[model samples]
Target: MIHNLFIRTICTALLLASAGCRQLDEEGLQTEVTIRLVMPDSRPVTCLEIRDETSGFYNINTYERTAFPTPDTNTATVRLRRGVYTFTVEAEATYDDGTTCLLRCADYNQITQAITWVREQESIVLLLKSVN
Candidate 1:
């Protein structure tokens, strides 16, 4: 009777462990991602958007143009499933001479680019170009 009880307990534990692992796998892994925006002329980001192409999940942020700090001030941290994403940004940069121009994300001659987030935590930087 003791031997049967021991076997049953071990089997029960194994089954529970397997079930938990399967559940975790089915849920997928979550990743924390930080995205930063940069403009060629060091402009303050007025608006930003990040989207997961596959999942259609997106986040947007808009900042007051008169904010003190300029470039590198636009940043966002979000939790997402490990996957690919795209970034969009709009900013108004004022030159020393009081000239202003709009900036948007551009990479390798493309207006938008795909970035992958696979690690538990990741940081990404995207370059913005003048749209005006």
Candidate 2:
């Protein structure tokens, strides 16, 4: 019967729509994050690392230090699963016999801004400082 065929077609359409929505929801769970670091003029950084509050730590510079672009000239970007993070950099000092130390971004900067990235968000910009 035509009525049975119409009912079946409607059910199929609804099922497909629900599937598509689930796919969209899964895709929306991730966010693209961009960290823009502001370096000091005195020291040049040799390594950079990012620590997710939820996840562990990630080394941004797996290749040669010179191979990776410095934040003084560029930015760092990564795809994260929506969470908070902290950035750290290691640099050699021009003074003090080229001493290398860990620089924490959150410690030096006074930025108390909280970002809640969502589905339509593009990228998050974080400004960090380098200290000895």
Candidate 3:
């Protein structure tokens, strides 16, 4: 149970909107994730994306990674089968906050665990603030 707030910069989200649609019939499962991405901080997040960590694996986005509100309001959506997925949360909190915080870089973003569609979700709260 790694529930510590470990923030770090990794890489940009994997844009998986190349094809129009992807087939998941062989897997024998179907689900739709209603992801509500919100920065619990005092300000709104610039942008966000949910992409798989493992390269070459099935993409989180079936058609496009920039889906506005597929599952719910204003959050990007990714529809696929029910299984474990290694994904990260990529979003620019702010560009010019006019501060001197060393941990305000883009690489200092947070990520979620191995997301599963079958399990019941509580809530994903991201507290973006100065690491001072």
lDDT of 1 by residue, 1-103 (tens): 9999999999999999999998897556767766676667554434433322211223222211111122344666667666655544555556555666766
Candidate 2, residue 80: CA error in Å?
4.2
Candidate that would win on TM-score: 1
**Candidate scoring better on TM-score of 1 and 3:** 1
Better of 2 and 3 by lDDT: 2
Count clashes in each candidate, considering only residues at least 3 apart in sequence or on different chains.
Answer: 0, 0, 4
lDDT of 2 by residue, 6-78 (tens): 9999999999999999988767776665556555445555554433332222323221111112344337655
| Model 2: residue 8 alpha-carbon error in angstroms | 13
- Error (Å) of candidate 2 at residue 129 is 4.1
Q: What are the per-residue Cα lDDT tens digits for candidate 3 across 1-132?
A: 233322221111122332223333433465555555444454443333222231111334342132223223335444555555444343323323533221121221222444445533323333333445
What is the total number of backbone clashes in candidate 3? 4
The local distance difference test score of each candidate is 0.55, 0.46, 0.36
Cα displacement (angstroms), candidate 2, residue 121, comes to 4.7
